[model samples]
Target: MSLVKKSLAKTASVVPSSTETHAPTAAIDVAQANAPVTENEQKEYPFFVAAIESDLAQLKTFTDIADKASYKSEALKRNDYLGYIKRYRLSGQNHHNTVLAWVFIWLVDLKRWDDVLELLPLMVEQKQPLPTVFNTKHWPAFVIDQLYDDANYYLSQSEQAGLFTISFVLHRLITTVKNQDWTGLEVVGGKLYAMAAKVDASLHNYGFAAAFAEQALAINEGAGVKGLLKDLQKLLKQSEPEQAVDAD
Candidate 1:
């Protein structure tokens, strides 16, 4: 027992009492670790908002359709439109600048069809929904909230969107025709011609329908489509002047 006690005391003495000791490992600072990289007050449009706004101000002065078209032409020649979209990140619909972006889409579809086409593939690549440049579900509803209380603004937008819609569809018709898509051409051509007969036997813009029919006939000159041509001609020969329909 004495020997065991001596051994224990020696062991205890051998453990240096003055050895340096370390504090326990500190716990991670969870709040600091999970903090956002960007501060809340930092500007979202820091890079090119000023430049974009300046360009947009110029567009705002282009209330005239012809003048606005000229601006679009000039911008496309210099590739200013594409740079604007990339710089402002205008491809998205959820940004703070959605209103501005959509307005840009409106003008582009009217006067910048090729640029609008240029954007379609990019939207597909980025997995973003196609912007309103191609498909607008309802024209007036689109502008009603934005152009509210100004009846003339609403009417002008509706009428202009209508004109643009027909022209845009015609553009598509020409594309499908060139691609030898008879079913597509037929489908598109049928809709326009049928729409002509809808309003009290009035051919609402059958001239474009006739244009599509002409293209379709040139592609497939079978007697099957001859009847359709005859029907369109009979309607065309009627005494009623063509009336334009607001693009729905």
Candidate 2:
């Protein structure tokens, strides 16, 4: 067997082992669900397994190709990487799960947070299984699994749904900070804080954003959230005058 094959077999064993150790019942349940297939989902099952199994070789090619491209400007490089992936997809079947997993790892390694947010759902859905350490499978599995929690947490707390949450929040945060958008900052900040608190009052991200909000408000002194917050407050004031005033 090639190194890749040996590593995958090793990974398959370790992933289930860790799960069994940590959550025995859950692991058993998943193992049963993940049992060797019958005929159903037959068309896609092999594809899924093949894609998962191909991680190391695929990732090696991806890195070798991406490194030779460009890494100058973040935006330019982001666009280049995205374009390269798109071209790769066009060249063959749209094995989006594989692409999603690789692209997320690439973007995260690049510190291209904007790109990561944009591609996060695809990453989440790919649901790559964890691999052994220093192996191609390891990072994707960790990212997909951890983000499953992050996403579920985001949804249970969100008033809005789908395509809007991460994209909007990501853009809003970056924009607000970049332009010194005090009102925009407050508005997005408040919504995120409230939503996060609803999910887990103890969530560290929530605490950080809340503290930052307090600082932003202090910077303005008496202005209050001036941009989107102001508009939201106005809407709320008109809609629920009593509640709005009380909140203020």
Count the clashes in each prediction. 0, 2
TM-score against truth, every candidate? 0.31, 0.27
Estimate the TM-score for candidate 2.
0.27
Clashes of 2: 2
List model 1 lDDT by residue over 1-248, tens digit each.
22222333454521112222662233433433344433311233322344344455778887787887676555433333343353233223234443234434554445344444444334334444324454533222222222222323323455555444444533542343343333534443333333322211222555555555555455445413455556667777673443333232
Clashing pairs in 1: none
lDDT of 1 at 180: 35
**Model 2 over residues 163-225: C-alpha lDDT tens digits?**
244434433433433433335344333433333223322232334334434444554443343
Model 1 earns a TM-score of: 0.31
Poorly placed runs, candidate 1 (over 4 Å): 1-46, 75-79, 84-110, 120-248
Cα distance off (Å), candidate 1, residue 227: 11
Best-performing candidate as measured by TM-score: 1
Q: Cα RMSDs of all predictions? A: 25.2, 16.1
